[model samples]
Target: MAQSSSKRIFLCNSCGNEYFKWHGQCPACSEWDTLSEFHPPKSRRKSNGAPARKTTKLHTITHKKDRKRTSSGINEVDRVLGGGLLPGSMILLGGQPGIGKSTIAIQIVAGCGKSALYVSAEESEDQLALRAERLGINTKNLHVSGENEIMNVLEQVSVVQPSLLVIDSIQTVYNEDLDSLPGSVSQIRDCGQQLLNACKQKGFTVIVIGHVTKIGTIAGPKMLEHMVDTVLYLEGDERYDHRILRSVKNRFGATNEVGVFHMTSAGLEEVTNPSELFLAERTANTAGTAILPTMEGTRPILVEVQALVSKANFGTPQRNTNGVDSRRLSMLLAVLEKRLGNFMGMNDVFVNLVGGLKIQDPAADLSIISAVASSSKDNVIADGTVLVGEVGLTGEVRSVARIDQRLQEAAALGFKIAIIPKGNMKNVKSFKGLKIHGVKSVREAFQIIF
Candidate 1:
């Protein structure tokens, strides 16, 4: 029989609550019965076979074979990953369900499709094969598994010894060494660590798929994110099939790069020209719609904004928006009604990003203001016109950051008119092809565009 020590029940590390015994839950926190009995550590496992590594000079560190990048068979993905996949690098790709996470991975492994081993903890072999068939990815070197056991993966690693290793999901993976069930913090951390160790020891590239929590952060403990070499987040409205993959952390490349993908019947298609997708749906000569050019990471793309105004029956009007912050919408409304005398307080206002894309850039200010004004006056702007600038609360148009990049994007998309900040004209290297009209205030911008 096990002896009890001083009736020493441990409190949850997350929430301070007393437990009579070690349990999976705390009566106070109500946190998935997460209360676990705390016991003194039996021992820490230490490795003894490897020689200690000495710190090398910076120039010498660049000569290693493992530092070289290998292509993932996808150009756009490679660009987002900073040239290509680095050997011994473990990347975590996360997204919501049905967001095509698996499709992207399958495409990535296609380059070495005939020379890699893929251990999928989430789906069985038959299901993976069916997906590959449907997607027309008949690669020779690819292997799939439904097993979640970590020991099985270790054995697979020994036999396959492929150039790349791919895991469908980190959540479904488990290790028999730990008594806790799979998908727990300890299990995920252990599994991720083991896989990373295997990759480094064998000199291979690895990719893991993770599911995002409700808060839009990756699931599992925060430490799991830190353990990976790079972290990529896939976000977009599920309603529209357009997805954006942004690099949040990269040990070897620029962190502010992004890759755009459009969901189609064939598979996830790489978006070569992102500008067309955002502005192609715009109606020519529409008053309540305006085009804005913004950059995600380093990729510049054009987007459109739309607004609608209707009379309010109740004393106060309702303000609603999609793809923009609700609190920011309220502040903008207050500014328009107070500074411009727009009489919008008694009207219902609706704002949308149009393509199911979420943009939180102040550079969209000019387009947003024009959209609101158009809705109020029921007047449409011009065809092939794009607006980019920040609008102050006093109805002044302020200069935005990276105006040149935005202009080049709009010009690339074949937009004819650009209503931009007056201050940007001086800094532009050359405006040879663009018709830019600079404005200092909201009134000036409206007058120039209309």
Candidate 2:
């Protein structure tokens, strides 16, 4: 067969738009300096007498009854994957460098009790072996390869006939036919497409490790994410010891589900009870600190919301936050000032969610306001008390979802009292040794807390 000719083109990394010539800014997305050189694969000519493709009816397609999921031998991982790993599905695991992306991949494939092939384009085989030793993973069923060429990697996959294949990074691998260098826009897209096709044809699960951009998205064409069956992001703060494996997209499972793990010398360890792990070091009766039961997927986690209110020395008061949105904090402050006559205008306010866990649950609104109020008044909320409600602009406490689950988690953790929205009182069930108080407004909540 004769080699097909290829043409050089420019592609926008942001929008995946092709251009015949380079431009300073992409005309499609208007992003500057995102255009990179690309060598697209030449299209093959079709014969004029080619046969028409046959389509299968959806109802006529047979479904497998005995097809069961294979567990990765880790409960937390299985939870995020919606039970276990599905055959022939491609998973994209992306995170910052040294955030345990590779370590977790090795552990998963090693524990799956199946023949696996791990191809590391970025690291040599010896380096991977040393890291595996550090992780204490020993398995004869796992095969290691240091090939960077996509064709050779696929060839090895064919020879090994493994049930699982891991590409240490999609960025480092390149196709020999493409003129673009590794990690370039064209190389990543072309290499990824080939890998996807191989995975589907060979009936093996593939986990592709990808590097994240400075803004924290997977550093590749947006199409890379769309091409995969699942997209997961490993996220954590550098100062914290815990890492969160969150699923942003899943075809076989639920999205936005999270699995918590603690970083250790032995690699990532599953955090069974994240609520207790997050609240292990709480100081009782501390002002500017409140507990909120927020749900991560179907699991409810109790995290501390801390606020600090101090006099502003400068002209403009600084509003700083960690693990909380600054705009939402400002809105809560405005509500406190307007409704309850509390003056936070001249105070430098800071709010933080403990354990480096970031939550967007509106149920945290009441807890944040309570913590701010407690700090401003120098009053401590009673110990063993939890808050779960959303604060509206009109100062009314709004109901949140899954109030029963949140309260049950609080009760299980020995919380004596729960301050919830009055609207949720109709659905509240009595828990032994736990008292529930329903408040209609922020003022009423303040009265109960202080």
Candidate 3:
């Protein structure tokens, strides 16, 4: 039997939808000019020989009691990866351009103290070396290659048999057999799958750096995320020096773990105590400012929540927020008005999370309310006081998870007092150096803050 000729197909880069021909707009994602031509993989020919029968009994299979983990020399990254990275795991790490994705990848290889191969599709080996040198990474066991072709990289991988593999920017790599340009939908999917298969078979850890679209999402087929063992995202704005490595998906460990890093001239530096860094410049006795302890996965972080309420300069008082959702702010403001009888509809309110960090945890609700109320009432919350609680729509303060962790973090940071939900008071038996004030309602919290 002869092999059939490969047929051409059009693929939507936005949604990975395949079509017979290119169209002006992708019907799947409704994106314009995202369709590109590519040749799909040819079907395998039927084999006359019988397929091999393989079976393994559960009792006969050997089970390893503990997973093999290697430290990546970066404490923050390791924490985000559920303590350490396991062998034979394929991790896809994505970030915006110049957001230290490559820096952290190299740091991991250098810090592991193992034989490693760095494959760069976007830059040359010399450029990688220069970056390593600047970061003070001098590992003789670490090797660098600048090949983009998946087959050639696999050949090198087989020859080197390195314990760790780093693929810089997977979008730039492609398979020669795939009739598509690099960074296209087909190229990213194919290259990622091939690399993942090779790494799993070879019993090595592969960290693939990926590019993000303008909308701050991983660029490529959504299936690309499903094919990997873990998906890590390096999040932070370029205008700020702090970067957060968050684990959105982890097969071997818990997700939502965050590792904090600071961008420095030497490279990305691990921040052991992010709470201190976030509150370092916080001014004392500020009317619109309130300190809040929020949990990021297992770690507790203390950050300042600030709100400014002023008379509206024009009609339709603007309600603005940065780092906190505007809708959530509106709800909190409405609660304050309805419960505390503080009229905010006629005033312009602005809420900001200091240090440019976004907070999704509902525990921050009470802190935001406190700050906004303090600004509105022209009163300053007592210094060295921390707040943590969730505000319900019915004017009651709800208890948040891990109250002990938040209290411990506040105590460690020299916070003397805490305003928390009354429901959490039952969970705390003793916490040294911190005073807890429990409030059943948002009105009670406001009375205490004032």
Best by lDDT: 2
Model 2 segments beyond 4 Å from truth?
1-6, 19-33, 42-55, 60-62
lDDT of 3: 0.87
Candidate lDDT values, in order: 0.78, 0.90, 0.87
Clashing pairs in model 2, backbone N/Cα/C closer than 3 A: none
Looking at model 2, report the run of 10 residues with the lowest lDDT sum. 44-53
In angstroms, give how far residue 223 of model 2 lies from its true place: 1.3
lDDT of 1 by residue, 197-219 (tens): 77776678888899888878877
TM-score ranking of the models: 2, 3, 1
Cα deviation of 35, candidate 1, in Å: 9.1
Q: TM-score, each model?
A: 0.86, 0.93, 0.91
Which stretches in model 3 have alpha-carbon errors above 4 Å? 1-38, 42-62
Top model by TM-score, which number? 2
On the 0 to 100 scale, the lDDT of residue 431 in model 1 is 51
Q: Over the stretch 265-347, how does candidate 2's per-residue lDDT look in tens digits?
A: 99999999999999999878889999999988778999999999999999999999999899999999999999999998899
Itemize residue pairs with steric clashes in candidate 3.
Answer: none
Error of 3 at 430 (Å): 1.9
